[model samples]
Target chain A: MSERIVVDPITRIEGHLRIEAQMKGNRIEQAYSSGTMVRGIETILKGRDPRDAWAYAQRICGVCTLVHGIASIRAVEDALNYDIPKNAQLIRNLMIGAQYIHDHVMHFYHLHALDWVDVVSALKADPQATAELAQSLSSWPNSSPGYFADTRRRLADFVESGQLGIFANGYWGHPEYKLPPEANLMAVAHYLEALAWQREVVKLHTIFGGKNPHPNFLVGGVASPIDLNSDSAINARRLSQVQDVISRMRQFVDQVYLPDTLAIASFYKEWFKRGEGLGNFLCYGDLPATNMRDRDSFLFPPGVILDRDLSRVHEIDMHDKAQIQEYVAHSWYNYSTGKETGLHPYDGETQLDYTGPEPPFKQLQVEDPYSWIKSPRWRDKAMEVGPLSRVLLLYASGHEPTRELARFALAKLDLPIIALFSTLGRTAARTLESKLLADAMQGWFDDLVSNIKRGDTRTFNEALWDPSTWPETCQGAGFMEAPRGALGHWVVIRNGKIANYQAVVPSTWNAGPRDASGQSGAYEAALQDQHTLVDSSQPLEILRTIHSFDPCIACAVHLADEAGDELIKIQISG
Target chain B: MNALKSIPVLVEAPATRDFCYQNTLPLLHEISHALRRLQQEQLPTTIDLNAIPFGPGDEQRLLEFLGRGEVSAHLEALGNSSVWESGYPGIWFIEHRNESGERVAFQMEITTLPAILATHPDDIAESLSSLQKALENPSLGHRIGD
Candidate 1:
């Protein structure tokens, strides 16, 4: 009997996402990934100031707050051919570096770790054994038995109260939880430590951009002002604080995050064989050098890997209309032309035509438009993005640190190179990327301080402040290697206003619905491949693969209120 | 450390009437008190947003006042639900919806971690039974649970 197991709202990751898998025996024969919410933030941007687009775009998702803001500014900057000051570039790099490290760490310990670690099982773990295990992993100072004991006590308290708190809703005691009690306790300890650590780390953004979530950004440069002595501006004191944040970030990633990932990953080596979706990977490389135009200067090189080919890399031209397109066939959206045809971002149309069944329906009409996420394709193929893609691109392009870390992780895990293609590999890739970025952040930070000392402190260019100097119309794309994947924001500026705006974020590329060609997106494809549910009811196996993508449906779609009003004014104006 | 000590305090964005929702002030106060209780007792509680009748203005004010923290999650497992941490620690906003993607439930889960995040034991037990049955009868085509 083929049973359909639905894990709607797969918890922990960002945003609302529903996964329905059809099982033949215990193996998943087919799967459907759906974004249940609809947030047409781009529509609100129409007729708004292009300079102010970042402020609005940044609201797209709270978790990936700064990525959208950065991408929006880049889109406007790219459209105007604006060149920012060197100080601005360095600060931007520092800000982005902070985001990658912060976001990736949170995802690991808080979001994705629960799939492997059994929290309830931690109650039985001996603090001494956990300390021994932690010490064996790395010299991370928090490996003392006392630390583990405190974490255990807190867990016991939460358990005794019958309120598991965040540990609630977890599949405790499931047969799939392979980690021992000691390992779980250690992971739980780090998870608590990370919550506190992140609070201090976000101070970097506040010091530089004046606030954390959705920091102020400007076209042609960053919004942060530079003053060596002024207390209010980016002064010497703030600079040192930024330095402090960087050192702390590096320590946490190297000591806690990387070591914990390897330690926990050793237990789930078989995961390296599961969840290899759409072997194609794409990366619009980020962390630029002196010149943003020069792709060769990017620390993480931009390229595409087709069919698991490590020998070659493909160029991704953002301007090439034939290269990237979005399909709305199986999505709750409609193109101006029709639902069957695809449209590039330059001509992207968002007509929210939700054709799915009304609420309270047990199962989605899988044969129809069931998801709000439009299927995005590169050259008519589903490509997986995020840390795995960036890491692979870095490795394929001979980026030294990426290759070293990837090789080191593979060696430490005793897994083959082919293992990098699976669920565990994807999670490990995020940790590895965090380490690489943490190291690279020092160079960017040092360069910024040196530039300031050498008497170059200009942060923004007022040259492009006036719209009258611009042409009547222009279109450009801004993309970055966001923590999740390749996030691109395209803008068509006309008459000094945002005429058309479309943001193809990371989750859209990875978590989108099936395209017109009926090819499943990364999440669906990965879930369908070699996924055998040990317990159809528990479905830990399904969550393992989907969560590996660190699925962020909030980035893909937006909040659909009670009105069931799907279309947010699909005004397709030429 | 000397340089840091002399640094001027950064000013926050001024409270403007443009974003304030006066009607929700009472509710905001209630939420504030709840948050205080959460801190004082280390007790987790749920504030069902759906239970309170809110106008559009009230909703806007609640969001502006609460702001957002670093972490948020959308769980589409059994239903569509959003779990976002508010600006305050231990204050989380959760919105759960049915299949049509309408908010069937909205809550402000005040806890160390939102209770909805962990899979309940009953759910696992039910799932275990379902899997056992599925294993016992692979040819049974009927849907087990709605």
Candidate 2:
């Protein structure tokens, strides 16, 4: 008999998620990934000014605010054939780069690290031994015995006070924890340091966007004013501040974040064998481009890798109705044409149909409409998208930095290239890309400053700013590589207003429910592949694989109430 | 306490704005002090923006006065939460809510990073055995710790 183990609202990720896995003994036979919320942001964008779409669309998720805004503007620009100034592209690149670094660092230390590090064990750690271990790993300057002692003291206080603060409600002292006391202590110290580090790094976003979350964005260009002398504008002082922030980011990635990832990941070398899903990777290339149409100059090439083959990269066409379509057969949505047919974003519909077992049920009615997220398929395939996909895409494209970094990481761990397909590999990929972007961002910053110095201070292009200048009806696809994975926004305009807008965010591709053909998504497929539970009640194995993808369900199904609350009322009755 | 009482609250002359907070002097002083500590020590601090029992529009007024800083993050790991640094270096605003989007925890964290952003050890302990068992399986078809 197969026992179904459900882990609802999987902790330490963005938004509410429920994972139901069927276990025949210790091995998982099948899994279901469900986003327990409805995303109606696309419906909200209907009949609104296409120019102002970024502001509302940016609210899809608080975690990835700028990516949507960028994608939204790019969609409008693609439709109207508007080209922004070169400086604007450079600034946008810098902002996106900062997001990747900031987000990846936070994910590694704060979100994913706890899956591996044993905090309760750290209580037994000797501060001096931890300092010695830190010194042996890397040249990070914060490895003093005093520093470790301070961190340990703080932990002791939290433990003794019976108030763990953020550390509360965790499954402590489980039989799964493997790291020794010293290693745990070292990771705990860095976890504290990363918090301080991230606070300073986000200043770059505020400097450019005026605010960090949901920053003001204009359709043509950024909303920031360029004035070299003004205290309020993008002046000399602010430029230097950006440079300082970049320096700080570089130091932390090299000194703390990268070293900590490698050190902790070294303990769980077995993870490199599991969590490999779909083996089909897709990347919508971004960065290192002056013009949006110039695909040849992309740093991360846009292509699809099928069956883990690197020989031929398949071309991507976001406009093809038959190429990329969303299936609703297994989701809590109804398609106008039928549940079996896939609808392209241009013809996408947002009809809510709840067919799952009502809340508090023992199990989801997995046979039909199990999730609120629509199944997004690329060429009718369930493709995995995220850092792992992007890194593989880069490695397949023969990008030098990615090739060197991937090879070096594999060699460092004494593992072969095939290991990159597993859970630890997925995580290592994020850290590798973070290092790559950390170096690439400086080049973009340099280009921006030099352009400003050369008197090309223009950022926005006003040629097609007005809706009257647009064609009577136009539709276009705006695609970019968000920190999570491939993000695309499709927009249709009629008489200068948005006829329809559909955003296929990263999480939808990774965490969506089953498709029309009963094919599992990246999350479901990966979880069921080789996952086993020592104790089914403690389904930490499921979280390990799912959190590796960094599931952000809020981005998948976007919406909240008047008080900006996302409240789901669950009824429990037999 | 008396020193806090000495600070004068700044009230804008009545105008047509939609919302106004009567007395924000205490909050502003705390923010200012937090900012000073951040600059001086390179520390991160957080303030609970959603938990206060402020009058009708005081939260909005306080946030606006803090102004937007360079970086903001939406953390969805545990719940729906948002963290942003004030224009002043170290002061941060953190707000967390439960699944239904009801505010559960809010604080003004005056540190280099907010406490909510770090992963706790207990979360890892739950999985160690599963990870170890997965490795112990000979059918996994991969070498471990070679």
Q: In model 1, which regions exceed 4 Å deviation? A: A558-574, B1-146
Identify the leading candidate in terms of DockQ: 1
Give per-residue CA lDDT, model 1, range A207-321, as digits (tens): 7777888788889887878887554578776788888998899999988899889988989888999898899999998889875677888888898999999899998988787
Task: Give each model's whole-structure lDDT.
Answer: 0.84, 0.81
TM-score of 1: 0.78
Tens digit of per-residue lDDT, candidate 2, span A361-385: 8889888788878788998998988
Please report how far candidate 1 places residue A529 from its true position, in Å.
1.1
The backbone clash count of each candidate, in order, is: 22, 28
lDDT at B38, model 2: 77
For all the predictions, what are the DockQ values?
Answer: 0.04, 0.02
Error in Å for residue B4 of model 1: 13
Each model's RMSD to truth, in Å?
Answer: 15.5, 15.7
